[model samples]
Target: MFAPRVALASLSGESDAEWAKACARPAGAAFLGGVAVDGPTREAARELVDRDREEFLPEDPVAFVDDQLAALDDEFLRAGVNVRATGLEPLREAAAVCAAHDAILEVNAHCRQDEMCAVGAGESLLRDADRLCEQVAAAADEGAPVSVKVRAEVDGVHLPTLAKAVERAGADAVHVDAMDSRRVVRDVAEATDLFVVANNGVRGREDVFEYLAYGADAVSVGRPSRDPGRVRPVYAAVKEWFL
Candidate 1:
């Protein structure tokens, strides 16, 4: 789980420097991944990992995951790191790596990429509640403290029900990309005791306070997270609230 205040939402497979930079800032925790996972060595996370070996996505996802995790310095380790993975098989490997590193393993049910969806991964898992819970359970079974990241307002997806199911599966937390519906955060909070993290377009201190008021244990900053300045006020606000 994250510290008090805001968290950094997954920003794709960018760079360890970028990740370290974020964690070095004021955010409570940083979520890494949306990492692709099809088979053990078969790379299928086409979005971040194309045929070319770009900045972050390499040929082997398992190795790539290790490299990304290894990039986290002592400061990041203490701040908190949650890794998001797409497929179940890949999640298994990710869970093992997270367990070893004392990090949180998050199952990504928030991605909407067509290729990942075609494989029953990403946001596609939201529609398949059983599959999503199964993946979450599998990650937990690996002895990894698991969290499920989900997007609310998606067609046909019942946020509350899905949250309860994730709780039943033994996930340690649920990160909700609540989008425009901040109320979903309260609903999910009421549904389960699992730590609830609210994510989306959190602009300033007001939005952060609003989500917290809605029962989010913590709020996550997405696009604006690249700049630490944006979250400083939010983190300050949270700390002040606790005082």
Candidate 2:
């Protein structure tokens, strides 16, 4: 959904507006926050903290989305928020805020955290296709562009099949964390028309070539994203390929 085709994936507690703003280099879009919305998700987020996990749990979830996105008005090329919630209402609420800023509302179906799964907010959604599609539909209904962040090689989950389902449910793009599966990106790209953004283990030009050769529209760098110098080599690779 953005040009130049590289993105910085969301890091739970650290991917706020200022962090996103500072890290916006050689990447087209920066996904901010895996924000916990609603009662169950917020409680699950708190439990994660005890285990040294990071989460964004604002006192006012919707307003936090509003303010964070407002800070990025024209400073960034594109921005998105990856969110977790046990209910559909929270998805709609966040999507409305996303629409206001012309941003993407990303449904987080990719998180593998135990706490997030127990609350039916993350990888658990992958196993429950019906629930994930419902959440995608709910968010898309709010008029913001929609993206679904997914991972490869989850037990009982088929990435290509899941990609088609989410596209039918109104997702405009699918961000795939390919993990160790080498050809998963090609399969997902072949399965649907959704913009395919491949993630994980990307370091330099060669990494970008592998994903693009397999049909990825873009590549996303996680963990090493904040250090632009570390990822600076990929920018020229992406720019040349996408241009």
For residues 94-210, could you state the per-residue lDDT of candidate 2 as single tens digits? 999999999999999988889889989899999999999999999999999999999888989998999999999999999999999969999999999999999998888899999
lDDT of 1 by residue, 1-243 (tens): 656556778766542435546656587677765565554213445443574432234567666666666666455432233333445666788788777767678788886756556666678889998888888888888788888889989999889899899899988889999888889999999889989888886777677777888888888877776677777877787787667
| Runs in model 1 lying further than 4 Å from the true structure | 15-17, 39-44, 47-56, 76-87
**C-alpha TM-scores of all predictions:** 0.88, 0.97
| 25 Cα displacement, candidate 1 (Å) | 3.6
Q: Tell me the whole-model lDDT of each prediction, alpha carbons only.
A: 0.72, 0.89
